[model samples]
Target: MNELFDQFDEFEDDLWGPIADDAMEPVADLSVGSAYQAPVEWNGIFTSPSEENNAYLPDVEPMDQTDLSSIQSLDSGELQPENMAESFFIEYPVFDPENADLEQIVGDPAQDMENWHMQSTQSSCALVSQEFILDKVLGRDVTEEELTSVATDAGWYTPGGGTPMNEMGRILEHFECQVDYDINCTMDDLSAKLEQGESILVALDSDEIWNTGADLDDILSEYFGMPGQDANHAVQVIGIDYSDQGSPKVILNDPGSPDGSGVMIPADKFMDAWEDSNHFMVSSGASQVSDQMIGNYYDRYGTWYYDDGTPERYNWDTGYY
Candidate 1:
């Protein structure tokens, strides 16, 4: 048996030697533009989950006068509520950032504004949130790959990698789902949705939310060329707890975190962070229109239509008018 196996091995090596040598040989004078290069790191600000062993609360001092003023402007109602629910939560899969690798995924990082690390976390939040809504809420067993492909096609995974508030809604609509892009919303609004078994994706200032020490103002100025400051991090709101008396707390499936577990934040603190981006959130619902039907509508009417349902314009390159 050994002699027979040795003979087979010798035959295989003799037949494949030349092919292997040619494949291993380096190309001569490869042009820099043509050379395959790894994806570049994103220059935008990012918020990573804190690794410190301390409790969820940051080490910073209690809300000062300025902080309280900011929180008050964002949250109008009194902190203490008369009839608050015990607690509410949504069941959803969590995606962690630490596991992302650029080499494994294929997308245009420059157009998406997503570095490899940001793509893993940000895309995970959108993909997992959509999956939960589809499978649990809408009774559709959609796979992760399918959802990722949808996001990639929608330009959600482009250069910057994170989906904008408006783009988030459009992406959900592409799946024949309805989405509400709520801006300047309050905790009560978020809590009410969760109580109704709905999940929300929220944008937050990384520095305020995770204490990442990121200068959001500078980062936005440099990366987006925008003058005003905005939230730099995105997460999904899954649960809420009122057990802390006047200080209600929110439970989030933060992808920026290590384990993608529920990270609780004080309501006031959350409001402070969320207000940076006008408390932007995306709430999705099962659409009455089927996916195929919507596709057909677009195919006929084109992508851009007037309020009267007439085609406003057409792009020949995309085959959409």
Candidate 2:
């Protein structure tokens, strides 16, 4: 194998980021009710909202775990070893999504999982983020265990290492999701996608994204005050914080940090970290197109693609395809 690190980002060593062991909870009954959203008004003319077309869900909270009876309090000799979440990956639980609930799964899974801010195990960042995106588009909870198990069985994830940098689309495709993968994506590509209201699963260097000094000991790591050393993290871009257009921050649901959800960092830092893995990314918005539809898209768009892997004649109204 080459000396260069393979592009992957499950969990390296639990060396950086917050560990929220107590926060990992089973995602059942996480669905929320839908309420009617008021329609827009134009020049004193208010459009009516039909029940089927106007319902909007409220802000969803991430999983809240309450079972902590196993934690040991300060006792003279009862000091048990800290509960290590990494131990769960010894044999990853293969969670199958097909058997998952498929009824009325119509809300963003992030709303139910709250961006799934909880930290991920060394081998579950991609799985966790994938769970969120899949569940969001499918409108239900697709457990991480199912994603992990399938990825492992499918050879997308190495036992101790992470996933290949560009297989995210194939994984999504395996689930029949309509996907677009880009190996050399640009910042404008990401911003435009977010503008269209779609979350992106991105691979960036954890060292830059979290500013963790875990890799500094390595001679090749960017000396202090720089990034692009460790290519070991996967996150989902939920939105872009444009409070400062000059230096807009990229908001992400980062699985590497303890409170990984709603994490934000300057766009430049994100881009630099992204460069560690060639700005590889994947976005899946609609369900996989039928074989007939696939034929039509290929016949129309051919093989020409933009930097973001978008077909020139893609139907953006659908997914910035």
| C-alpha RMSD by candidate, in order | 24.5, 23.1
Lowest lDDT 10-residue stretch of candidate 1 = 108-117
Tens-digit lDDT string for candidate 2 (54-79): 22312222333345455775543211
Q: What lDDT score goes with residue 312 in model 2?
A: 45
| lDDT, model 1, position 228 | 45
Candidate 1 per-residue C-alpha lDDT over 48-123 given as tens digits, one digit per residue, 9 for 90 to 100: 2222212222232212122222233333232112111221122232222243342322221121112111113333
Give me the runs in candidate 2 sitting further than 4 Å from their true place.
1-113, 117-120, 212-229, 288-321
Error of 1 at 260 (Å): 2.9
lDDT (C-alpha) at residue 100 in model 1: 34
